[model samples]
Target: MKPVVQLLYFGYHQAMSCIFPVAIFGTLALTRIWEVPFLHRYDAILLILLAVQYLMYSSGLETWDEIKVICLFHVIGLALELYKVHMGSWSYPEPGVSKLFGVPLYSGFMYASVASFMCQVWRRLRMDMTGWPGGMASFALGGAIYFNFFTHHFIPDFRWWLTALVFVVFRKTWIIYRVRATTYRMPLSVAFVIVGFFIWAAENIATFLGAWTYPDQREAWRMVGVSKISSWFLLVIISVIIVAQLKHVKAARRAEPG
Candidate 1:
């Protein structure tokens, strides 16, 4: 295939893989512009996402296993949101029946959307990995990264240290993905940064759409700081590791004797 054709194919698959995220963003933009008569924006978003999920499943755009993964991330994300809101890292600041301790239930769908993208892209791009860290190392790193999101608030921030460890641990890891008949590989760390950067960009858009607000944005909206890329970078690592481990487990189970 020609280089231009391959690029187009790659872009097409990527867009297809972003169905869930796109839906969430579209809902955010729409709700920001138009108020629901009888429903709060957050509650409306939750309902819309639930309907979207059903549609995706009914249409065979998502598998049962993928849905399970997305559900897990939703819970994980909600837990983080609860803690973050308590700690004043950010606030929903929106009134809704779905609000729990000042955090909206619809917020979990944001994180679930990331998992949805990972699962979809993994399948669409025929993704594989080389030199994946062992389960112990990967899970431990993921755990540490997650805890740091909370611990950093109370103790000295260790994000940079964890960031360093990520590079060291994934030094030999590479992601293999296909575009049409051709396969391409990139360092896993580079992939993490790429995904994180895009997520940060999306975060800016989400904030602008009043999906949520940072402390600084209480009075007016502003771009999220570039430093947030590191946070999202770590978050992307955790999301990727979880999805990868789940895929690995499924593969291993399939390889077992029936």
Candidate 2:
């Protein structure tokens, strides 16, 4: 295949994989401009996301297992949101029946969308990894990264240290993905950075749509700081590790003797 054709094919697959996230962002943009009668914006978003999840499953865009994974990330994200809001890292600053301790229930779907993208892209691209660093190592690193998000509030931030460890842990790892008949590989760490950067870009859009407000944005809407990319980078690592571990487990079960 020609280079331009391969690039187009890759872009097509990436867009297809982004259906869930695109839906979420589209809803954010629409709800920002259009208000619903008898429903608060946040409540309406929650309802819309519920409907979207159902549609995705019914339409065979996501498998049952993928839905479960997305739900897990939803819970994880909501937990983080609750803590972050409590710590004054950011806030919803909106009234909604669906608000839990200040965060709208719909907010979790933002994180679930990330999980949905990971699962979708992995399947669409037929991605596999070499030098996986084993399940225990990956999960431990993931757990540490997650806890650091909260602990950093009370203690000194360890994100840069964690970032360094990520490089060391994934130094030998490479993700292999297929685009059409041709296969390509990239350093897994590099993939993390790329995904994180895009999510940071999306975060800027989400904040602009009034999804939430950071301390700086409460006065006026401004671009999210570039420093957020590091946070998202670690988050992308956790998401990837969880998805990769689940895929490994499924593969192991399939390999088991019947």
lDDT digits (tens) for residues 112-190 of candidate 1? 9999999999999999999999899999999999999999987999999999999999999999999889899999999
Candidate 1's displacement at residue 233, Å, is: 0.3
| C-alpha-based local distance difference test score of model 1 | 0.95
User: What's the true lDDT of residue 240 in model 2?
Assistant: 98
TM-score between candidate 2 and the true structure: 0.99
Model 2 per-residue lDDT at 116: 98
| RMSD versus native structure for model 2 | 0.8
Clashes of each: 0, 0
lDDT tens digits, residues 61-156, model 2? 999999999999999999999999999999999899999999999989999999999999999999999999998899999999999999998899
Deviation from native of the Cα of residue 143 in model 2, angstroms: 0.5
